[model samples]
Target: MSEKFEIRREVVVPGTPEQIWAAISAETAGWMFPSPLEIPADGSRPDSPIIADWEPPRELAIHMQGPDGWFNNLEYVVEARDESTAVVRYVHAGVFAEDWDNQYDGASKHTDFYLHSLGQYVQYFAGRPVTYVSAEGPEASSAPEAMGALRGALGIASGATAGDTVTVDVPGIGTVEAIIDYIDDWFVGLRTENALLRFYGRNAFGGNVDAAHHLFAADADGDAATAAWQAWLSGVFA
Candidate 1:
């Protein structure tokens, strides 16, 4: 139980550090976590990762030992890279105390997917980004299978490449306009006129697929958009 490993990921998005900072406030927590995680009260770390260091327009680092009880400290670091991009690094350093194989593998894929989603979402924040809306579907499939369900539902070919302007007929949302911004076996990202969306194909506890939705929106369109998208996702993954 002494073996250790690290899962590192980084990305560059289109914006200055200052801009990226704004996009990642409490509002965008949904884009990362499965739910909106309220920022812990100042100087308090109760099971949740404490905001160890935050130098806005530059770096934000939080220190926490989670997936808790796993005996590991995870640090999520963000570094601004000028006005057109930024980098995020997720460091998971700890002993392979238990379930190392599964935990490490999932962490590797998920960290990559989340970083990409966050970067894309931040690219079009519009200065008025609203709270993120999130939802999850079933726990009965693999990540690839979960992603396959979404692609099949949207009539998107696995061959679809980024930068393609495609329109998908969402089950309950009518026609939705989107530009494919990122695609991989484990995740797919889309840019809509009013928001950024993601199909996260991650494995959950029960060998089920963690089908998730993350969106960046405005106060006026938040509820409606969340309803429409969550409805469509339910239909697709249900």
Candidate 2:
């Protein structure tokens, strides 16, 4: 019989089903795995490198590049126990060389990370207290000041870059760095599936204001380099 592995985990996120669906469905190829192989987004290969069989809020099937030029398959089935809790089952199936027994452990570890990351993303987007910094003053001055403070306070640690992780301290939202997109003038754009939140300065002027504005759909949860600036401005100014 071919070797196989299965990993199961349940996560409770304080978001609507739509939000969870969007997060899970978003391209996670290079973001979710520790060393995810680069595959064409269109899955044009004769043997599709990455394929997703998606049924929103219910099931998702992923086929990724695997060892021996083979493909590893993962099926995620989501069952909503309530408005806030979701039971997720991940099943992995693939042919592996006998010497690669340890691959099972690696796969399991990757699954754990995936579930944890998804939970955090969902919770944060659901308006969980990820960070909250209070700025006392007029919106103009306080906003910019708060933005600068957040940027400085989140000092540059080693290896902090786009797609990496870092946290910012807000007065209400605790310190959390699911992923660092980039630091803008007023706010940083934190990558999310549904939107990119622009974290700006609290006291800054028209372009410099401390706030989180929703941008647009993100290609990956860890992609901080590209943002829908035009769409974001339209939404914000509108």
Candidate 3:
């Protein structure tokens, strides 16, 4: 027998519903940091997609029908929270044939950070170029020890909260000061002077832990940004 499943991720982002919608609608690419946001839209889905529904500033749902008639879906929705903020939601749900557990584990972790970057795009780097670099870890997508090492490197405590100031002496990037954007159960995001950085700790399908990093720089200096993150991760997982 086959099983149906659903996973939902939501976050309150620092923008009006209209502003957030613009960024979300801008593109449907990797949703990671190093991916550029200025690619021209061709009115074509990144991959072959069967459209389900589209409501501006509200919802975008697509059907991912496989050869065997199974369903895999991706959806995004936003609700206005107030004049200056809104709630953004992403859901990747449906049926799968094999390795559903491990695949969804990666999806769950990836989706969380993806939304974090989207919220960041709307908040700080709208209309700017971003250099995004992502790495799958020694467990690359979810490791508590890695997160701990990162929190230490950034001078943030385990109980850090939003609004806390953080300063990390990044090896290739020099000293960077940022404010804690938010802290969640397995995720943390930072608003640096010139970039948005996020980390994720998640479980794989088999229940083993893994981790990942996504660093987005709006400074257009992709080489420097990538080098800094690559060096940083090498140290963290060394």
Give me the candidate number with maximum TM-score: 1
Compute each candidate's TM-score over C-alphas.
Answer: 0.74, 0.42, 0.73
**Global lDDT of model 2:** 0.48
lDDT of 2 by residue, 54-166 (tens): 56767767787755566677777777768767666667777665535555555555455445556655665543313221112233334434554445455535445667665
Higher-lDDT candidate of 1 and 3:
3
Quote the positional error of residue 206 for candidate 1 in Å. Answer: 5.6
Most lDDT-accurate candidate: 3
Cα lDDT of model 3 by residue, 146-232, tens digit: 566656766998778999998888777788888888676556677875666666555323332232333345355656666666667
Ranking by TM-score: 1, 3, 2
Ranking by lDDT: 3, 1, 2
Which candidate, 1 or 2, would have the higher TM-score against the true structure? Answer: 1
What local lDDT does model 3 show for residue 35? 23
Q: What C-alpha lDDT values do all the predictions have?
A: 0.61, 0.48, 0.64
Residue 52 shift from truth in candidate 2, angstroms: 6.8
* Model 1 alpha-carbon drift over 4 Å, by segment: 1-5, 24-27, 34-49, 65-83, 87-90, 94-97, 139-144, 203-207, 216-231
